[model samples]
Target: MLVSNKLLVDNDCPMCKAYGACFTRFNLVDNNTISPYQKTNEAFVNDIDLDRAKNEIALHDTQTHQTLYGLDALIKITTHKSQLFKAIAEFMYPFLFRLYKLISFNRKVIYPSANTAVGRDCTPDFNLKYRLVYIILVALFTGVVLHEYSVSIYSFFGWESSWFLEIVVCVGQIIWQYVAVKAFRKKNNEALEYLGNMSTVSLIGGLLLSPVLIIQSFVVLPVLVLVGYFFVVVSLMLLEHIRRCKLKKFPTLLSASWVLYRMGVLVFILTIFI
Candidate 1:
């Protein structure tokens, strides 16, 4: 099952590293063929488009001396493994390709690398367009989840449920975090990365609510149960926010500010706006 090809991945990306290791461990690629473009010799690196490879992984054919990239390279390895796997890969090419691009484009911000090596770096260039896309999509999801949750619980707290309020709150979070980052006088890139991570936390909380949302579609749960679960999700989101903030070496007070914004917004919506 050993394919005679070298797969070059970003050593800094945990996803990429795990991908390469999985290929090697599963005998999908030859032993010692999974390499980091950063550490690979210039001769081997010169064999492929280094820039393109940085964005999408590169697979160099050791035997034919040819190169394939991104999903094509992945399909190539599967082609060597078995007809069934190869067929499945080709069948799901469209969805998988988009998913690959989404992950590839945001990999750095998804898990910012702390590696400051002096040698060649394989870190993908930060694409603001994709980063914004990620943020917007996450915001939309969060907004929808909040809108639905508010509808379910507003009556319990004697508060009016406004769909528009949920959307405003979601958008407000982005602005609030941006202001927080600016208050600390962070550089533009750092600010953008922090915003991306913050949006991811919101996204995580929304996803955690999804199952309960689905259940609510069929069964009306008690208000206290819904409220308690919401708080539980929020607690987890808070811990994750703290962990990611620490990962980026951001100030601990940033997490405090993050929680403060949500609390302030909740108070405003429940008391004044409603």
Candidate 2:
């Protein structure tokens, strides 16, 4: 159609600010042409609702006299020039829309770290698919570790061992933690974030055991094991506290339950190899 229009974006929005650059990077749209919504957004915000215009990507086509919002707006602008991006956007639109809503819904919890004065980096991604991919990878890595440790033990008794139980335990921890959180106090919208955070912190704790396990190969280091356990426990508590504070929830029962389950998992696995 070759219809001409400038993309209007909320300057205050972190996503809007970031996407402005993305348009240029994709080479589908020029950065200069994508105008801040503050100037012209007011023109059509009443039609689309001011909040909608600010929260989602909004485009005002001066030539066609039309306005587009949300993921559609992004697709229209970026995919116009590239069939590859267009196809990709179609494939991931549903997931990306959900991810955008997650971030939009939980701006308070995720944005504070990016303090302008302190220059702390922002953590903006809450893409559910990305989180799923991450957790699975972590779980798989942990599975490999558990399998190796289990096989080593079986060699002494000349008995074969399967990682089935160990793999289940490794993956079960993440699911159990989510169930605990949902059971105590459900934050339906934050479920993905909850799972993602749990997986991330658990993976970190699991990695800490890697070093301790390596040391245990030569000499039994009880002190190191205790220290590793302490670090992992403290880390989980700290993360839960921050998560609660950010989500404006005061329920610690779920947090405590999650911690207990993780600690239990660690102990159970330790007994298997030790």
Candidate 3:
């Protein structure tokens, strides 16, 4: 009972975006017609009567009243071109399905689902490359910003300091951050992933530090230091709690602790001479 070939897709998923092109290339559609599930009314979209569409790449056969999602839909779309591909797809489905579920899980975290029970197995998509690079860049950017604040404040107070050594120490701290994480977490499983995760959490926590530090230098506000410390602590605590609950044997706890100490140093001005 195959109905007319109208491939409805969750426009929100990057995987579906790729699959949509497959539909066009195979002449499955005469026009570009992938409906973003968020806007699409699911009542007309066959077997997925509820809105599980948001968490999965849904493809429905209106005639058969059958629906496929994630790896199933991908296999369906590719199976027609070659039996070999279908076989390969079948072989890969177990792993791909899990990966797909993981991506779906992260996506739902950002744009929740009407059906929360879906994608229960998907873990956090650490997004190692992008997150690692972002964390590195942010640290360097924050370093420069803090350097300027240091020079200004120290100069105003008639003190002398070697900024070159300070810069070297700051960069060293970032590098050792990775080492610390591996040291603290006993398992050493997914060390790079843990490092990336910790860096991501730390960066988010201190995102406001650079600007606030610069501002405080001019304004002489007493509470700004505490505010910065609060930001970093909230981020650290959030990550620590997440690790304890989700990744019990995870690495990077030591590195994260060191990062907390470094962030504290940033707020030390308010700590002393009070």
Candidate 4:
């Protein structure tokens, strides 16, 4: 179900570029037509509302010269593959549209966009509601994963893991980072953005550990194996933190503070709990 459509995606956003590639890869649209709005010609760009396209993706119909935005564009492209999906999409439009907005609003914060000097920068407007929703959702997810992982290792420490404690710690990390950023950087506006990036790192670390948590549910794995895997995930997270910090142009001390917070937590756990 190939459509004669061109998707103008935010080139600076990796996720947007990836999906654009996917549409072509899966034959939902033509390979050559998936153009970056940043690099798209001025004449072609005039086909759609530029402001709306920045907030939501723009899909241009080559033949009809019609443009659709956000979930409408995606549903149109994807539903072409199957009638069942089309029916489901039609039924679930409201929920799916909200979900799409959530992701679209937070996409830049999820992965900060690269510098775009050549053309239109398709950065979505910062909506505090969406930002907080993103942060709270990731915090909850990370907290739950931490609570489960902590319980798995509780036998070694002779302590029980509390969901409340883990959730508090999850929140505390955000607060701690926010305080540190404010204290050092002194930029109130950038703090939220920095916290968003930090939360993303936490989310990635939690996601990495989720498989081990799942495996533990089925089999009784050794404590050393669990700890080893956790260390590996932490190491990967460290690399990610460094990469993100570089992307954000944040100081090395912020990364240092990140490590310091975990180390402090480790010390607190070993001394008091164990």
Clashing pairs in 1: none
Mind giving the per-residue lDDT tens digits that candidate 3 earns over 7-49? 5555544555566876776665445345555555445554664
- lDDT value for model 4: 0.84
Q: What would the per-residue lDDT of candidate 2 be over residues 2-93, giving only the tens digit for each residue? A: 24566766554565667777776767675455766656535544544445655566676765667787778878886887789899999999
Off by over 4 Å in 1: 25-27, 41-43, 78-98, 116-119, 158-160, 272-274
RMSD of 2: 8.4
* Model 2 bad stretches (over 4 Å): 1-16, 24-40, 46-56, 69-71, 82-167, 178-259
- Cα lDDT tens digits for candidate 1, 1-274: 6566688888778888887888888877778789877787676666788889988999987777789999898888767757898888889999889877877888877766677644567877788888888888889989999888768788776767777878888899899888889888558877888888888899889999999989989999999999899999999999999998888887788899989998998788767745
lDDT of each: 0.84, 0.61, 0.54, 0.84
Best by TM-score: 4
- Give candidate 4 regions above 4 Å deviation: none
TM-score of each: 0.85, 0.49, 0.41, 0.93
lDDT of 3: 0.54
Clashing residue pairs in candidate 4, if any? none
TM-score comparison, 1 vs 2, better candidate: 1
Model 4, span 1-274: residue lDDT tens: 5556778898888899898888788878877678888787676667888889989998888778899999998998889879999999999999998889889988877887557647777888877887788889999999999888878688676787789888887898888888888876776657777888888888899999898888888998988898888899999988988888888787768888888888988887777675
